[model samples]
Structure formats: structure tokens, C-alpha cells
Target: MEVRHKQATIDKLTHENATLKRLKFAAGREHFNAEQRRLLEDTLDADLQAVAWWC
Candidate 1:
């Protein structure tokens, strides 16, 4: 893959990882409703699909 493409992908994945982590932490603290937690987990798993190797 092209370096630019890879870099961009990595950057996007990093941003998403940060967002999901924040969501997970907030959810763990009971900030998210049950439905919200389910959605967050699903989205987080989907986001991880972009960089499964890194994980």
C-alpha cells in the first residue's frame, strides 16, 4: 500500500481508537445507557476492523 494511504489509515484508526476508549471509559463509569453501551461496543469492534494487525 502507498505510504500516504497507510498513514492516513493509521491516523484515522488512531482517532477512532481514542474515541472508542473514551466511550468505553465513560460507559464503564455508567455514563452510557445499556443501549448506548451496546452501540459503542459494536462501533468499536467495527473500527478495529480497519487495523486488526495493529491490535
Candidate 2:
């Protein structure tokens, strides 16, 4: 039981780390001006919030 719990935790952390890395890579893929960056960030925030709400 203890080993199973540890493995589950590891899996969750690994998934979250991968998600963050992907988000970072996507955000860095393009260069934006300050205004565009703010808009992009706002859009990402809204999308993330929607995802969290669903989760």
C-alpha cells in the first residue's frame, strides 16, 4: 500500500511537471510586444482557469 501510494504521487508530480514544461515551451515559441504578451497571458490565464474549473 505504501509503495503504491508513493508511485501514484510520483506519477502525479511527473504529469504536472510535463504540463508546465509544455506551457513554457509554447509561450516561448513566439516573440511578442508588451501589449501582445499581456493579451496572450490573459488568454492563457482564462483558459487555465476554465480547465481548473472543469477539473
Candidate 3:
């Protein structure tokens, strides 16, 4: 990927990862049901992979 595109992907994935982390771990907001949490976990894994590629 081009540098600019890669950077953009990384930024997006980083933001997603942070959001997921908050949703998964934040106090008083652990509203994810079991299935929803599972999906978020999967998405977080993908986000980590995407950010790792750019890094």
C-alpha cells in the first residue's frame, strides 16, 4: 500500500481498537452481551492486525 493509504488505515484501525477497548473494559459501560463482546473481540483482533501491518 502507498504510505498515505497505509497511514490512514493504521489511524482508522487504531481508533477502532481504542473504541473497542473502552467498550470492552470501561466501567459502568460494559453493555456488550456475550455475542456482542465476542464480535468486538474478533474485530479488535482484526484492528490489531491492520495496525501492525502499517507499523
Candidate 4:
């Protein structure tokens, strides 16, 4: 891929990661339960890993 395209992909994934972090934090506010929060966090982590591998 072109350098510009690669950079854009990286930026987009970074944005997604930030968004997921926000979502996880927002979810944490109400349901402080262990399982739910852990799942959300795990999802976010998987997303981040996928992005990293893709880039």
C-alpha cells in the first residue's frame, strides 16, 4: 500500500481505539460488574491488536 494510505489506516485504527476506550469507560460508569466490564475491555484489546496486526 501507499505510504499515505497506510498512514490513514493507522490513524483510523487509532481513532477507533480511542473511541473504544471511551465506550469502555462509559460502560464502566453504571454497571461496575466484573464480567461485563472484563468483556468490554477484552473486546477493546482485541480491536487494538487487530489494528496493530493489520497495520
Top TM-score prediction, candidate number: 1
Each prediction's total of clashing residue pairs, residues at least 3 apart in sequence or on different chains, is 0, 0, 0, 0
True-structure lDDT of candidate 4: 0.76
Model 2 residue pairs with clashes: none
Q: Rate the local accuracy (lDDT) of all candidates.
A: 0.76, 0.66, 0.77, 0.76
TM-score of each: 0.64, 0.50, 0.59, 0.52
Q: List the lowest-lDDT window of 10 residues for candidate 3.
A: 23-32
What is the lDDT, from 0 to 100, of the residue 4 in candidate 3? 88
- lDDT for each residue of candidate 4 in 1-55, tens digit (9 for 90 to 100): 5898789777878788687767768775756578876887797788777777876
Give the per-residue lDDT digits (tens) of candidate 2, residues 9-50: 666556656755776797668566899768766876675665
TM-score of 1: 0.64
User: Better model by lDDT, 1 or 2?
Assistant: 1
Residue-level lDDT tens digits of model 1 in 1-55: 5887788777988888789678768665757778977897798777777577544
Locate the minimum summed-lDDT window of 10 residues in model 2: 46-55
User: Which candidate comes out best when scored by lDDT?
Assistant: 3
Query: Candidates 2 and 4: which is better by TM-score?
Result: 4
Q: How accurate is candidate 2 locally (lDDT)?
A: 0.66
Off by over 4 Å in 4: 1-15, 21-29
Error of 2 at 33 (Å): 16
